[model samples]
Target: MFEISPTEWTAILLSLRVAIIATLVATPFGIALAWLLARRNFWGKSILDAAVHLPLVLPPVVTGYLLLLTLGRRGMVGAWLAENLGIVFAFRWTGAALACGVMSFPLLVRPIRLSIEAIDRRLEQASSTLGAAPWQVFATVTLPLALPGILAGMVLGFAKAIGEFGATITFVSNIPGETQTISSAIYSLIQTPDGDSAAGRLVLISIVIAMGALIASEWFARRATQRLHGN
Candidate 1:
């Protein structure tokens, strides 16, 4: 009853690939934005924060629709990129990754921002006073201290990406072997005859992956707290 067929395996592998690519590509941006939000107090900061977290509050379908309008084949930005750079997003696996990344970005940034905020400014100041350049201080002090949060955020974002349904499907249309993820595969399975068993198996897989990610997040959080407390 729990057997996973080759097609299901394909969906599973594709989901993993999309999630990984999304998380990796979004991490640096997450870190940079996190630092900005945590350390800076510029004009329109609140607006930027709200924009960053918009996906969290908006319906997934709405977010996906917005992405389509902005990045679709006929979209303003999309058309330009396709015409000049030959890059396409709509109806592609890369589109799925983009949707996942955008959807998971809020989750990716929050913990990182909190972690950066929790870091000791005095440590940074001391490093700077010791002739370390700004980049050196950030690399040696800020980044090390924020590693736990970054890992936690990445795990959270990855888990979210793996389960993403509405945005990814809306953007990429769930093409098998190209853009089909586990969630979309499960959705398709449940709509077909004799697909219950496959859907159930995928559901179990999703549960396991989510539980593992949460566990890993907890472990990282604990380690972060311990390190912060000098234990």
Candidate 2:
């Protein structure tokens, strides 16, 4: 059936909201980390790289449990935040966003790192010789040249956030109209009697969203390539 129920619509909207927030919140940090990995050498560089990528290797449930321990209401950080700042993450949509952001962070960093690594150092050297400040050089030259990769990273992160399930449900417990995302809703639907049709609809919607994001990413990548080549 082509009809989507109100609950399904809520889940869809909530998924979009969480994905967008996660992407926006993670982007600046992603760029900075990508730049560091691409352009700088430092103590514990390997450790940092491994840490950034740890999520990809670890079970999502483990990540979520770790987050709960560190950021739940009674957690060390969470308690301090709640006491001092009235902020709470456990069982909240904000918590879902945080979980999504953490899970997708590596996706947001890899493409940008590759792009930055691909940049010609000679171009940077040339800019420095022209007396451009480091910040100015990065803002004007490095960032612009790396825009395509940054965009790609954002899209990838967004897609990852949209589909995130294990971490989100573990951290926030899939509360409807709050933390219940499309994936979680579909999961709930699948467990109910005669819920196959609703579950199927959600699956179709998920496919459409994922495909759209992939198409957009590819189109943007092509456009960026064309622009780079002055086509």
Candidate 3:
């Protein structure tokens, strides 16, 4: 898309990878936390709820820095990972994915939690009454009921992760074909001389991708809800 270089395409591709990885990594935890927050009664639940949403309200740079400190090459967890698994996150694409994941988590959880809350607990109870175990009931009843919400959350999180800038950059420096994403590429173009033409191209592509994701999610969610209601 860029006028002078392959940077724009590389950035777009890397950004897509980061967003996909982040969404996949966050899905299980998002569903679990959403179920817990919506269905469980426990002490300090509000605190957990607030913590889940902390990323949404906090400065992205702050979150990125925290991730760096905790997961950087020499940081505690990072040290262990390096020593044990020979894996490192600092300035890596994986680190960028982590940053995007953290930043997008709140958006992922909120809608799923609301969906979980909307589920009829009675259906789960009925499943249990029919000799289904807790896990079985959740799998068969609760999860099916919550599909639409979960889909919405996933779509939202993926979109946010795709657009993540501050956290991604702060945690992982923009390295072309490594950690450089569309947002970072766009930012860089905006800073360079006569870069507006290329920037405009990338922006149009970004808008199309975003609109596509939104439309797909809307259709899927509606169809899921309709099927569940019919059942």
Name the best candidate (by lDDT). 1
- Report residue 88 deviation for candidate 3 (angstroms): 0.9
> Candidate 1 lDDT, tens digit per residue, 60-146?
999888889999999999999899999999998999999999999999999999999999999999999999999999999999999
How well does each candidate superpose onto the true structure, as a TM-score? 0.98, 0.96, 0.94
Q: Give lDDT per model, in order.
A: 0.95, 0.92, 0.88
How many steric overlaps are in each model, in order?
0, 0, 0
Check candidate 3 and list the clashing pairs: none
Name the candidate that leads on TM-score. 1
The RMSD of every model to the true structure, in order and in angstroms, is: 0.8, 1.2, 1.8
For candidate 1, what is the TM-score? 0.98
lDDT of 3 by residue, 1-231 (tens): 336467777888888999999999999999999988988899999999999999999999999898888888878998899999999999899999999999999989988888887777777888999999989998888888788888888898999999999988998988888998999888988899997898888888889888988997788678667866776
Runs with alpha carbons beyond 4 Å of true place in candidate 2: 227-231
Query: Ten consecutive residues with minimal summed lDDT in candidate 2?
Result: 222-231
What is the Cα-based lDDT of residue 111 in candidate 1?
A: 96
* Higher-TM-score candidate of 2 and 3: 2
Stretches of model 1 off by over 4 angstroms after superposition: none
Sorted on TM-score, highest at the top, how do the candidates line up? Answer: 1, 2, 3
